[model samples]
Structures are given as C-alpha cells and as structure tokens.
Target: MKKPTMTQTLLFILVIGIGLFYALKYGNKAKKDIAEFESKKETNTTTKEIIELKYFGEIDLNKTEEYIDVLTNINGNEISIDLNIIEETISKKTIQPTINFLENLHEIEKIAHKQVLSDFKNGNIVKDYIEHHIGEFNDDDLKSLGIKTTDSPKERKQKFLNKIYLKRIGFYPEEWDSLAIFDFTISRDLTQYLIVLSFDSNGKFVDIYTES
Candidate 1:
C-alpha cells in the first residue's frame, strides 16, 4: 500500500491512542476492585441477636421520680418488703461463678442456683458458693477460678471464707404466698446501679427492664 495521507494517518494514530488509554484505565479499575475485594475478605464479621434485657424498660438514675414510679407499679401490691437492713459491705464467701455465656453474662448468672451448679459440675460444691457471693459477670465471670465441689458432704468442715464450689438460690421460703424471686445486683465497686429483675418460673417477665 502507499503512504497514507497526513489527515488519515493522524486519525488512525488518534484512534489507537484512545484505545490504549481506555485499555489502561479499565485495567487499573479492575485491579483496584480486586484489591478492595481481597482487603474486605481479610476482616472478620460479627453477628448479634437482640433480646429484652431489662425490667419496665431501662431505669434512669438521673430521673429519681421515674424509678420511684416504676418501683411503685411493680412493688405495689407485690409481695415484697423494702428491707432497710441496709447492708454497708455485704459480701458473701460466695464462690465466683464460671462465666457461662459470653454475650449475656449477667443474665445467665441471674437464674443460677447453688444446688443446680453442684449438679452441673458433678461435685463442684465450693465453686458454686464463690460464684453466688461474687458478682456473676466479671469479664470471664470466674472462668479462671479453679474451684471444685461435691454432693458428698465435705468430709472436712468448711471454714469461713473458705473458697468452695457451691451454688446459691436467693428465694423466699416456699411457705410464703405469691412468691417473687426478684434478684438484683450492682457493680461490686459501689456502683449501686440496681440490677433489677422480675420473672416467673415460666420465664415470663414481670418487669422486663429497669423500673426507671
């Protein structure tokens, strides 16, 4: 073929240049997208399940009246006495409970009992005691406490503050009418934020969240 005309040659070169530029841009975009996808794949994902975690909703410490109102609604006509036996440093030789559930630690501890725990460990009586007396949720919740127990009565007498694997069920005597096992706890560090709870034997929530 003969030499192409100037304009024709220029047009051909322009088309090739545009094609090359487009190829480069698309290649770069594809590479960037792949790199982003790989980066995302390296990260871990978490899942969460929501559930009602309180009584009468959440109690607000700032709104004293609000707590009073809810407490009235729940405590009024309910079989409970506002025991002013105000304990200053109430501590039990309670064995630290092994944390059962990671996500909802306090909730699991709420329903725990001494005898039931003794049964679970097959003979870990001492640990159950420490767990009940100690706050239930403490990070691992006593996962590290290596306490043991036994149904076979302690061959040797248990001493005071003697760390043991035991369980505790804080409930009103069976003879009492209209039973209410309203168990509550607060931060052992004097954060009197009441851990108010109200539930029946059937897992029904009388007061689902904080009264306030």
Candidate 2:
C-alpha cells in the first residue's frame, strides 16, 4: 500500500481534531443540562419545605399518605379536615392562603353555618320553592288528588302549595355531597332542593345560592 502524503496526514489530523472538539462541547453541554435539572429539583424541594414550615409549624406536610383529622364539633355537627380535599379543590398558587384558613377553621365554621342559615331564611328559598312546584301540576294532576273542578287556578295553586312545606336544612347534592365545605338541603315535603355554598381559597364566602 502507498503511504499517505503529508497533506493527507494533515487533513486527517484536522478532521480528528474537529470531531474531538465537538464531542467534548456536546458532552459538556449534556452534563451541564443534567446539573441544571438537578439544581432546579433541589430548589423546588427546599421551597416546599420552607412553605410547610412557615405555614404549618410542626405539621408534617410531606406525608405520602392521605391525611385526615377532626376539625371541629359545633352543635352536634362534626366537621372533618381532609388534606386530599384541600389539595384537589385549592390551587397551588393559593395553597398558602387555604392552609391559613384551615388553621382557623373551627371559628370560621361557626360563622359560616350561621350565615348560611340566616341567608336561607332571608333569601329567596321559599319563593323559589313555590315557583318551582307551582307550575308542575296540571288540572288532571290536581283533580287526581281530589281537587274540585270548580276551584280557581289561584285556589288550585294555593292548595298545591299548602301540601308542600320546607322540611329541614343540612341536605347535600347527591354528586357533590362529600365535596362541598357546606351544603344546605332544602326540601318541600317529598321534593329535594339544593343550595350550594362556595368559598374562595382565602376562606372568604363567595356565594350561597340554589342550583337548578
């Protein structure tokens, strides 16, 4: 075989040098990317630790399992605090505020319960109930219940309304029964009415209204 000339040898050496240079550059870049990812992961963990310590004092926030505790018992009503509920309903950005609210939940619960009852009494619950069921019964439906045909529409409606009466509070929607912080079930005899109360992450009462 013929030996390569000086120019070929020089070209080969230059190509090898370029390959090594790029290999080292990309290898270092990959290592740097990994290091940065690890650093960010560590920073996030540290931040979570700080937040837990700042807000919860001695409570262990890093528990891998579900955490639940009895929150308060007011007037025979036993309220429970479930970490899973807060984690699901509350956003990460508002987690701190939500935690702060939970810390004072015992007192807040009483106020919330009272306000809900007051609102139920003073609000449109009765009117809404009447309106909902009044149009439901036709002449045939009323007559089946032994109402006289001579009864006026106004009288027939009043008779229907008379049969209906608000039963009690503390009812929950079938689907969201376990989810809501507070649910007031209003019933007219056999029929069920739903009133859902919503609160913000900061534990401020947002609204209390009936759901269709």
Candidate 3:
C-alpha cells in the first residue's frame, strides 16, 4: 500500500479533530435535552397528582354568581348594615346571636346550628380558624372529615353547608355584588374552622375549602 503524503495526513488529522469536536458538542446537547425532558416529565407527574387529589370536581360559574346574588338580595338593600352586624357578632364571639341573625336573614342555608349553639354554650368561639385552598382533599380525605360523597355538585355543596357554621362575610372592597364570602366554623367545639371560602376572578368556586 502507498503511504499517505504529509498533506494527506494533516487533512486526515483535521477531519478527525472536527468530527471529535462536533461529537462532543452534539453529545452534550443530547444530554441537556434528556435532562429537560425528565424535568418536564416530573412536573407533569406532580400536576396530575394534584389534580387527582382534588375533591371538588369543577366550579359552576353561573351557580356561584346566582348564590351570591341570592344571598345579597335576600340581605336587602342595606349590604353594609348586614355586613357590619355579621362582622361585629363574629368579632365579639357571640355565637348564638349570630346564628339567630343568620337564620332570620334566610339568605344562605342554615349552618351547623346545633354545633354553633353548643360551642357558644361551651364558651368556644372558633378563634383558631385557618384558611385552606379548594380541592385540597380526595374522596378518602372527605370521608375522614365525615363528609360523604354526593352524586351531584349541588348535593355535595349542601352537605358541606350542613357541616359548618357561616359566621362572617368579607365583601371585596369594590365588587360586593360578584362575591360569596363564607367564614365557617367546622367543629362542634369550635376548634376546627374554615377561614375563607375563596373564589376566582370569574366568580368560580375554585379555591373553596375548609382549614382545620
């Protein structure tokens, strides 16, 4: 076989060097792509897990607004007066008086009446109420909380109402007409309470949940 000339040897070395450089560059790119893909996979898994853990199925925008309207209209023309009475009663920890007032309003459904009365008689005020985001529970979690799964969303909401006492209403400063505020006491002893019933900008019951 004929030996390669010096120029041919140089060209061969250059080609090998170029090939090695490109191989390293492309290999590193592939590794980075794989890492990014894995990160995305993990993020998607976390999101799916969160969705599966949700208790509330979906928010009914129309129904949410309708409830707000019903509560507001039934409270009468003086929204501020109703709000003040509620806020004051809750702040003073006068549980029965508030229950009576709420009953008279006939706005929202009757709350955990017996428990509220018992708490008041027992000198409990639900002062330790905490906030929670909606869909923070699965079926198992609802069962644990003594909340049975209902066939329909309406039934589910009704069941939730039956378990808690609505004590306060904090209307958004400007958009009072478009909101539903429920500050609930969840335990007979007033130890467990839901600090806020959240709503999204679209008046959807998205983050509605109770905090222990």
Candidate number of the best lDDT: 2
Query: Higher lDDT: candidate 2 or 3?
Result: 2
* lDDT (10s digit) by residue, model 1, range 108-153: 3334333233333464333343334344434333323322343123
Clashes of 2: 1
lDDT of each: 0.33, 0.51, 0.42
Residue 70 CA displacement from its true place in model 2, Å: 8.8
Better-scoring candidate (TM-score), 1 or 2: 2
List, in order, the clash count of every candidate structure: 34, 1, 0
Per-residue alpha-carbon lDDT of candidate 3 for residues 27-98, written as tens digits (9 for 90 to 100): 999999999999998865531111110112222221222112223433332221122222211212222233
* Rank ordering of all candidates by TM-score, starting from the highest: 2, 3, 1
Global CA lDDT computed for model 1: 0.33
Candidate 2: segments with Cα more than 4 A from true spot: 1-46, 50-74, 78-108, 116-122, 130-181, 186-192, 197-207
**Best candidate according to TM-score:** 2
Ten-residue segment with the worst summed lDDT in candidate 1? 93-102
Q: What 10-residue stretch in candidate 3 is worst by lDDT?
A: 47-56
- For candidate 1, the per-residue lDDT at 210 reads 23
